[model samples]
Target: MQKLKIAIITLITLLSAKTSLAQQYMKFSWKDLNIDYSAFAYLIDSENVIVRINSTQSGVLKLAEAAGKLRVHPGYSSKARVLEIGIGEVIYSKDNKMSGSFPAFRLFQENYDPVTNKVSGRSYVAQATKIAQKGYLSSRPDVKVQVYNKLSDVQQNVNAAAYFLKEEAYYKQFAKPSSPATNNNTSTNNNSGNKPAASQAATPVTVHLVLVGDTKDASIGESVKSDLIKMRSLFQNTMSVNKNIKFNIKEISGDQLISTNVENTVKSLTVGSNDAIILYYSGHGSNPKGSNSDFPTAAMIKSSYKLENMGNLVSNRNPRLAIVIGDLCNSVPRTRTALPDQPLMRSAPAQHDPARVAQLLIKAKGKIVSTSSSYDEYSYSLGNNGAFTNSFVDALTSAINSHSNMSATWDAVLKQSYKEAYNKTRDIVNKTGTKGQNGFYRGSVAYN
Candidate 1:
């Protein structure tokens, strides 16, 4: 318990005492539209608005699903594909309507024709409505989310063109700095007397979010994007009570996540004694030649950032503490039962070697590193989130809020995350197997 308490406090106390901004919100716009509605499809509008949340921070887009009810789709990021979120009626009303009076909104994947493999008949509004009335809606949804592999189903009810245009225009205007981005929310310290009593030095806690989103790679999907947003939200909620830490976050994302850019970004930053660094990567994780192999080398991955190289970069920085997590397929398969429902639209489970996994862990040894998949089992992602990373974010946020004192340590946090990722990826394989929820059906009678 003492070790755990120190570990938690060490992480929190390392931040600089001064105030700084977090990369909290990203103004989103439609970047791609691949909704699976076939050549001939019905275009209808059910319920939507330009977008507004009375308060600045609204995290209400975290509930209701029908790709089989109450499912959670982690964050997603793509260069070509973009999905914007809508504000539910729950945000507008203050009557606590959600408890009973006001029903919950449902989100089901649009259905496809069993024979043609094209989305047949369905309105986005109707699908969402059904989930509100019929699906297993949660008063407090805690189910492990199984990411829908087919993204077109996730945005089943959206109007591609119109939505893209509206959000793009809106983001262009909103992201622009208003009045030189000035803020009047600072309070004066008023230490006018003698020398201010030699105050304690503010520790510098730099959180670098090095994310890679290969939207062009269909395999990558939206998980990367969602991981970025959710990670920030998790930290925000967890650190809300601790005012002593000053946070500085730098995002090396999109095309900039290449090796050169990543290296340069690290070089440009400075870390003082007792300072800490938090590193997160969610793109593609590969091992020796992208195939089954013997023990892996330090930097075997061929994506934006190499595994070993990333570890070394942080070590050179010499931060008092660091956590580097990689959510990708190292695919070292130990024998596990095959995923269910393959005859339908499911992909086979990946085989990974445990020895290879150990090699990858070697590079991350000093930095509390974690991989999404073990030996050769391919990891999964959904929406704008990497499946493992989403679970990771959830575990951290939940751990922080678990005890009022924030007493949980790095081990506890990592344990919660790894367990969740294992279960989530396995469930996705099973549920998405033969006879899946790829189509939609509305009964003659309403759900309620």
Candidate 2:
């Protein structure tokens, strides 16, 4: 009897060690949406659960179904089984009224012990809430329990098994390897900083910036002006390093903000193969009814022009890179009231690395088309600056000031900017009861 007891204790220790190892946090990517997910697996009592952190509504739904179909052979608890799959709501409330809710999910487990003729349960819940200031979801621990007595209880719950099973079938059709065992899309940090190769350093490049703003609009005129100034400053600071790199900026505002003038300006510009052209417009914008494209049209005083047209023109020049940005409302026009300036707590200034800036602006090759708001969303302005523009500038600034040993990518900048803009818009809407805005970006830039 003593020897048997020792063996049992040894087996229990081994199982606990295995469970601890399995609980290591993992990262995954949904390549279809270019979204990354992080999760960790662990056991709750005798039940096994996988918790995914900071996921979108689609991601949570998909993951919840995947969790239901997940079968653990020789699981931590030999008699454990998946009991439930559902999303936890992150309710956004104002004045005691629910304004919005972000979707979150968790996997729950139940175990039966034959010796004790008893059942036990536990769950791991993850909330899909924005990280403060960062505006993106991150993995954090949040656990809750909702026990079900039997299989019938799970069926009776609003989060029915049938729903998860149906979703599981739909997701299984296109599901790539998301499990840690098969996940190989891990991101590695490049500590090489922004140092260009000798050949790239010798290449002469010219960055042409065409900034267009509608300074006539009473609502966002000052904001447009501020955006232009900030953008010019960003470019000048970034390009100040290489003597071989020429930085040229063109401003078209006031009466020259017409579509013809804008077209003429882009038409007359001559770009070389080693050059980059950036067109930024800060003004009213809209999506026409039944518009096919996801991009918005720049709403000028008397006319509206498609941003895709400008993007194509810039791309036609065959420059190394082309970026077209429109910071405007994609929905119907509405009167915007500028909020009073709130003093922000400033952090210590980051030391800028010119080589890193050059890597993104000069060495990179490809086009980027982005907008301040998605279709049918309002682009917001705070004080004298558009929220998206502020977020973009901040992202760029952070990239430039990143650790000298770390590499920066335009993709990261764009994603960060989009998330930050979304968070900013959401916060403003929550506070002032304004419409929310979510920025969008597409295209890729390749950097060596």
Residues 27-131, model 1: lDDT tens digits: 111111221111111111111101222211132221111111111122321111111232221212223223211222222223322233233232232223333
Residue 262 in model 2: shift from native, Å? 1.2
Cα lDDT tens digits for candidate 2, 423-445: 76675552235556777778888
Q: Whole-model Cα lDDT per candidate?
A: 0.36, 0.55
Q: What is the lDDT of candidate 1?
A: 0.36
Off by over 4 Å in 2: 1-200, 335-337, 402-407, 428-435
RMSD of 2: 22.7
Task: Please state the error at residue 198 of candidate 2 in Å.
Answer: 6.3
How far in Å is the alpha carbon of 158 misplaced in model 1? Answer: 28
Question: For model 2, what is the error of residue 146's alpha carbon versus the real structure, in angstroms, after optimal superposition?
Answer: 75
TM-score: model 1 vs. ground truth: 0.46
Listed in order, each prediction's TM-score against the native is: 0.46, 0.53
Best-performing candidate as measured by lDDT: 2
